[model samples]
Target: MNHVLENPVYSALRTGDSHLAFGTERIKYFNEEVSPYVGFAHDDANGFADLYELLPEGRRVLYAKPIPAVIPQGWQLQHEIKGLQFVYEGSKNIEGDFSNIVSLADEHVDEMIELVKLTKPGPFGKRTIDFGYYHGIFDKGKLVAMTGQRLHAENYTELSAVCTHPDHLGKGYASALMQHQLQIILNHGQHPFLHVRDDNDRAIAVYERLGFKVSRPMNFYFMKRL
Candidate 1:
């Protein structure tokens, strides 16, 4: 699972719905929509079984391969390399004013995309907000930083899409938004988790400073028809 692919997959999960909807194809594991794709089928197996089973009759599985090997221990065998990062559960206090947090709507979609482009955080678009809540920081009516949630399992949600504009970096917006999201997850009675590339030392450091610990490294794979 190279960092590029790994990051987007996890981002999609975190910023999308609990069942993970990609383009259109929906995947069900244990009778739940866990993942989706534009051109893939929906089957249920350890590796590529779901994919194969969902394909049209006589249409061979194209992108069916194992995920990368560098995943966290708890999810190493799941065929998806993305793993989870856990923030300590007990401490749920946020130390900042959240009145400035703004919710984005249809009219603000273009602005949100531009913000994501400037920050280079991860894959985010208009649909990203459809899955989870997104909050942003504004300085004099200009969007500067933002964070959101994604990927919902039984008792957990992935805290992700944390990014701040370069010009506004070091202004504590990331920390503030993170705290806000963490508190939201706690209110829902779920633990917060996230994933980061191993080479992103700076972001990792910041998360650590915020009391988040790396649970394990995950991997991702892309399978195409052969």
Candidate 2:
């Protein structure tokens, strides 16, 4: 049987993040300001046509799936990314030194965006923090490293925006922050999962060490309504 993770974004919108979703029941998407992701309730390629009808021209969106999708016409394909999805399978909570970590709030959104720009950890926007549970490491009052939750699909929560400042690399900040997230999600009776570019060896290694097993390969389509 196919699993929920195979269509994670759709699963998330239908379940955990339903409040942030909008669109026809068959074709749903997050608020553009929060994320550029869209999903279909079923694997039918015709769902893309439903999304195209719902979105305005030039509206950008990303579609991800465990298997490659056949792009229907009426959309401009900007690019594609090969990705890997991982899910935490460890039995115990991760332990870490979280002394330097601080919970980020509305006041920190600007800093968070700036950090995201510098580190390029993935698609992050002003209201993305509304996903909640954002925590960061500070150095002399400057936000340097952070990780947060996204795409909560029922019992699973995605660990996203796991990035550290270039100058702060090798200090274990990324690992520490992820471990903190892992502990929190596991404690809440939810499993943690995330997607990283297939070429991101460093991140893949860190996740493996943290007990996240590679669940599947994914295809990411970045496109816009035509």
Using TM-score as the measure, which candidate wins? Answer: 2
How well is each residue in 138-215 modelled by candidate 2, as lDDT tens digits?
A: 999899999999999988899999999999999999999998998899899898899999999999999998888989
Task: Give lDDT per model, in order.
Answer: 0.56, 0.90
TM-score of 2: 0.96
* lDDT digits (tens) for residues 39-64 of candidate 1: 22212233344444444433211121
lDDT of 1 at 151: 56
Candidate 2 lDDT: 0.90
Off by over 4 Å in 1: 1-26, 29-49, 52-84, 222-226
Error of 1 at 177 (Å): 0.5
Could you say which candidate leads in lDDT? 2
